[model samples]
Target chain A: MIFAVMVALLVTMVLALVRAFMGPGLYNRILAINTFGTKTVLFVAVAGFLFGRPEFLDIGILYALVNFVATVAVLRLTHLQDPWSGTEGGEAG
Target chain B: MSLLDHDPTGVASAQNRRRKSTVRLLRTAPLPAVFWLLLSGRYEPLTLALGTLSVAAVCWLTWRAGLAHQSLRLAFVLRLPRYFLWLSGQVLVSAYGVARKVWSPRLVLRPVVESTPAADLPELSQVVYANSITLTPGTLSLDVDEDAIKVHSLEQAGVEELRQGRMLSRARRTEARG
Candidate 1:
């Protein structure tokens, strides 16, 4: 059952990935990735607990660490160098 | 050649030294951490202790990849009751709004992104803000920037209300923890 839930959430994230790929801009893609990371963390933890292994919680923690790293990397990629720059005409409705 | 032996001369040839140092660190340093976890009975203590070498190997790689730090030991604990109260209120309000849209003849979806200034909060506070936004029905925090957040809302008014940073009121709660 937990695996089923994880799969369902993964499916939603796949839709999100499409948006990220067709990204109107960098911010959109980063946002999609952030959402994907959060879902992945929950999926790991819930599945771990459901399986009665609880050992998978370690993977959940590691996922969270990696997610934080990924966010920081994305932020650095988008903002650290660009600082004050905003997209000139990329606003999408 | 016995790689474990220490050199009397401090420096080795660069190529072999780099490779040897990398493999050496991968073997020694993580055993203590893996042993601690096994002793603590946190996970499957039995599996962990019995599989000590395997656990150590994984820990070594995890630490090498820089994932194994003693996770932040919260000096101030997570205030579950207060957080729960706030979360439930937000959930109720959001659900009500979503229900209204569902019942209405036309599905009203006015999507907007409000710029939210995100200064004066710690990193965890920012994370909390982003996560909280997702839990709400009418809003999704698309991404967070140093002094700003981009929130997508289901209605113009919701977007406006969020831009006002009422959502950031809880940042103080995380100040101590961070």
Candidate 2:
């Protein structure tokens, strides 16, 4: 069961990567990367449990914090540069 | 020649600020201390001493940066476990919904962007609401401004649910005073 969940998470991560590459605008890329990061955190935690090494959860927690901060930081920096330019990529909505 | 040197009120207010920061530092210290204990899982004297030193350093630095003031109120902290339980349920339901849509053969997306009123919520509550929206699947918080939050939802129903304000009310409740 755990292995199946891991496989599912891996598939989601691949999809997120595809989105990241194909996404039209900077925000789409950022959103995809952020989603990828979240899946990675979940993958790490599940993998830790599968391998019987619970210490991996700490890394998962750290990754989650980093992912959130990185998303916000990138958003802030881009908004400062061109706040209104990304509306053309509204398809990601 | 300096502002503090000439104005007694300025000196008093500066002193008051210092005192308030100290109180906040004391209140925030236990959080890091507990985190260290949980993460280290070590009770030896040397480890305990090091943990104390590190926690103190972290608390002092955060206090200096004026970040300690951002700590949640006791009422909010006490209610967090219940809030998280409810949020996890929402996450599970939405994740399943989004996953179903993703796996369907023909993509059925009715994306909409709408602004929801958030003027009544406190700053912290607004942040909680926005983060919760992002955490749940099918909806993303595009921007949060003084009086509103712009949300992007994969389906019209998601925006309608958000507009109904169940999550907003819960977010506000979490920060409510005892």
Candidate 3:
């Protein structure tokens, strides 16, 4: 069961990467990477159970934190560097 | 070095500073200590002692950096588990949503960037809300401003869900107990 979960996570990650590569713009790539990071967190947690070394869950928690921090950092940097870069113009309703 | 002489300010305020630092240390150390214990997973005296030292060092550094603005309040802490459980359920639901979109034969993405007002939320919850948006599938928080959050969503539904203000209110409620 855990193995199946891991495989599903991997497939999602691959899809995210594909989106990242075929990005329409910078925001798309960032979103893709962020989704990939999230899936990696789940992948790590499930793999820990599948491999019978649940200690990896701790690392999974750390990865989740790192993923959030990195996303915020990258977004902030890009926004500061170019206020209207790849982000869509105007607020969508 | 004397017990409290580490305070460079040579005055009565020095004692107050030392006391405040000690209090901050006590407040901040426990969370990191617990993290260290869980991550290290060894009960030996040597490992425990090392973990304690490392946590103390980290706490001291954070204190010196003036990063200890929030006091440890029990009420807010108690509300965290409920908030986390809710967030986790949201994560799972959205993850499945994204998986379905990803596996669909047609590329049914109608990406939209929307802004949600987040100024009313407590300061800490603003971050929580932003991170939660990013963690959930189909929505990525592109910019977390003081007054609003700019989010990029893979579909229009994701933007609609965020604009509904459910998750933002929940995050604010998480900190309201204190």
Candidate 4:
């Protein structure tokens, strides 16, 4: 069961990567990357359970924190570039 | 005499503020200590001493940064578990929905960027509300302002649900004073 979940998570990460690569806008790419990060965190946790090494949860938690901070930092950088870019939410292709 | 030399009221108020901050620091210490212990799970003398040092440094830095000034009511803290339970349910439901959409043969997305009023919520409550939105799949809090929050949703229904204010009310109830 956990193996199935991990496979699903891997598929989701691949889809996110595809979206990031084919993004029509920066926000879309950022969103995709964030989703990928979330999936990675889940995958790490599930893998820990699968392997019977609960210590992997600590890395999972750290990844979650890093993912959140990285997302916020990237968003802040984009905001600096153009204040109205985030709020408009229009495709930029 | 110069204004800096002998202003009794200034000196007294400064001392009082310092005392209050000290109290706040003391109140803030235990939480980080507990968090460190839970994460580290080691009781060796060296590990324990290092944990204590790190926790103290964090507490003092947060105190210096004025982050400790915003104290949550005990009622709010007590209600957090209930809020988290409800939030987890929402997350699961929405995650399922998003997953179905993702796996569907044809893409079904109605992306929206909408702002919802949040002026009535306290600051901490607003943080909770925004984070809850982000935690749920298909919805992300783009920006939180003094009176409103900008949310991006993969589907119009997600934004509609937020507009209905059920989540907002629940978040507010958590912080409501007894």
The interface root-mean-square deviations, each candidate in sequence, come to 21.9, 19.8, 20.6, 21.5
Off by over 4 Å in 4: A24-26, A75-93, B1-9, B154-156
Q: Candidate 2's chain A scores what TM-score? A: 0.84
TM-score of 1: 0.47
TM score of chain A per candidate: 0.70, 0.84, 0.83, 0.84
TM-score of 4: 0.80
The fnat score for candidate 1 comes to 0.00
Positional deviation of residue A17's Cα in model 1 after best superposition, in angstroms: 17
lDDT tens digits, residues B79-133, model 1? 5457657877988998898889978998777777776677766656676777888
lDDT of each: 0.69, 0.85, 0.81, 0.85
Ten contiguous residues minimizing lDDT sum, candidate 2 chain B: B1-10
Report the lDDT of model 3 for residue B93.
Answer: 94
| lDDT at position A29, candidate 2 | 99
Q: Write model 2 residue lDDT over B10-122, tens digit each, in one string.
A: 77887886787678788888888888988888799999999999999999788665456666677798898898999999999999999999899999998999988877777
Better of 2 and 3 by lDDT: 2
Clashing pairs in 1: B118-B147
After aligning candidate 4 to the native by TM-score, how far in Å is the CA of A38 from where it should be?
2.6
Every candidate's CA RMSD: 12.1, 7.1, 8.1, 7.4
